[model samples]
Target: MKPHRYQGSALLLALCCSAGLFLTSPVVAEESLEQRVTRMEKLLESQGLVDLYLRLEALQQEVQMLRGEVEQHGFDMKGIKQRQRDLYLDIDRRLGQLENGRPAVSPGSPAKLPESTAPTAPREQGNPATANPGTEEKAYREAFDLLKEGRYEPARNRFTDFVVRYPNSGYADNAQYWIGEINYVTRAFEQAIVEFQKVLDNYSSSQKQADALLKIGYCHYELKNFAKAREALQAVITRFPKTTPAGLAEKRLQQLKNQGQ
Candidate 1:
């Protein structure tokens, strides 16, 4: 009976210990579980891995930054291209404007070209085969025909008109060259010199430039402007030494030297 009582007391102690372990352990575990759940929720929010709206806001910020950088890069590239184009244009203009290049002449200024100042003929009464002319070459041909036909004044008038009507035209340079030729034929050496000078000063790229220099030197020789003639003739030789103009300059310079000595 005493043994049975002690066994019962042992059973009661065991039950108490089991109950204390369960209560204390579950309470602590419950608090820890709540804290762990709260921390997981905060971490999920920070990761932006859930909730469509917050993710979209973060994605939008990234997209906007990328767009801004792309736009800025495009603007910077455009500015660099524009600057390169401007520099190229400036260099091209300078290269083309070399020796004998006349400064940009203002309109209505006294330095206004004499051929440029000549009067125009009325468009009406133009001859057949010379009529219906729309371009500079046609006009120049018509003028050359008139000059050959001994119509001196009309030819001069036509050439002057050609030069004025198409100032930058390819044939306009030829028209100026012809004016000097006409003046040389008529023995107006001073006027011939002036017209030929215009070709050299204004049309550096013209095919007739070398001829213009030759003619100008000839004009100076005719007028007995020997020093001026020597300068013009020598330039023809120096500038176009491989061409017919240079040959003519060398021959004439020798003649002038022979006359002097």
Candidate 2:
């Protein structure tokens, strides 16, 4: 009876131990599976962070390239604006020249002649000097009017008629001067020189002497006679020191010196 009792107690203890081991093994397996799943989740988050960093770097590079292109375009726009301003200034200068009717001369050239305010009618009398005072003025005024109107040929003819019809008239020198002016303005430099010389030769007392000399110098310059141009310009400065033409001649001389002429 004592042996049987000991055997039964040993069997019961063995069965209890097996049941405890079974339950604890399932709990350990569940904990291991949870740890593995947590590790996988951490690895996936790290990979996503690396991909986002690479995309950000690429976007920054594209922004830098776009900024460089914008700067280049801005530089090109500045150049285009400068060219447009230069073009506008050039057009304005050309239009001003056209409206003036006189060719654009060099920087130190003579100024344009004054416009003549005179009538446009022929004299009915034969001799201009011996004729009535009003008739003489009318004849001179009519000839001058033609010159003011840019009728060069008719002006030349009328002046020639006046000089012939009234040799001793006070306005004869003025008429001759206009003839030279007509030639000078028309670019007939040689003819202008001849006509202007007549003013110095025949009308020494006339006030147009300085003006004629100045034109002579200008004509010589156009003809490329530098020596004669210098001589004539120098003569103007010496002969008419206080005159406006003298100042013009001085300016021209300075220009020549600057040019090494």
Candidate 3:
């Protein structure tokens, strides 16, 4: 009886050990599956972050390229405007030479003028009726030749002498206008204004009247006299409508508006 009881106890111990091993195997398998899923999720998140960083770098490079294009376009536009301005000035100069009956000087050639006996002396002031037409024309041409040669001081002096000696000549108004132009070009705005006013007051019937007024407005603008500039520019538009000077005044008015004046 003692041997049989011992055998039953040994059999119950072996059954309990088998059950414990079966349950523990399933729990270990589930833990390993969960760890594999977590590692996959971490790998996908890291890949997504890397892709986003690469895309952001691409966008920054595109923006830099666009900025360079815009700046290049602005420089191109400025160059075009400068060329247009130079062409306009050249055309106007050619037209002036034609109207004055003076031959255009070639770029490299020296301008020729009529011979004068008293080159340094100012001719005596006289009435146009009594003044020799040949002498008047020659004097006017000499002064214009000096201007075309870029001798501004000599041109200014010759124009002044022309005005003083041949005030009644057909070219007297033109001479006065050129004097003002020289002053304006030299940045003597106040003196230019005074000289331009002479053209308006003394030569109201001259073809240069409109241009003189236009230049006066320009001088006033340079002098920072906004009111006078506006007044003179407006007068040109009103009095010389359909003329080149009027067109120039309109352009200047637009510039003043852009400046908030």
Which prediction has the highest TM-score against the true structure? 3
Show model 1 residue runs off by greater than 4 Å.
Answer: 1-135
- TM-score (C-alpha) between model 1 and the true structure: 0.48
Q: What's the ranking of the predictions by TM-score, best on top?
A: 3, 2, 1
Writing each residue's lDDT as its tens digit, candidate 2 over 210-229 gives: 87898798789778787898
Q: Give the CA lDDT, 0 to 100, for residue 9 in model 1.
A: 85
| Residue 127 CA displacement from its true place in model 2, Å | 6.8
Runs of candidate 2 exceeding 4 Å displacement: 1-129
> What TM-score goes with each of the models?
0.48, 0.51, 0.57
| Whole-model Cα lDDT of every candidate shown, in order | 0.70, 0.73, 0.77
Better of 2 and 3 by TM-score: 3
Candidate 2: count of backbone clashes, pairs at least 3 residues apart or interchain: 0
Q: Which stretches of candidate 3 lie over 4 Å from their true place?
A: 1-130
Q: Could you tell me which residue pairs clash in candidate 1? A: none
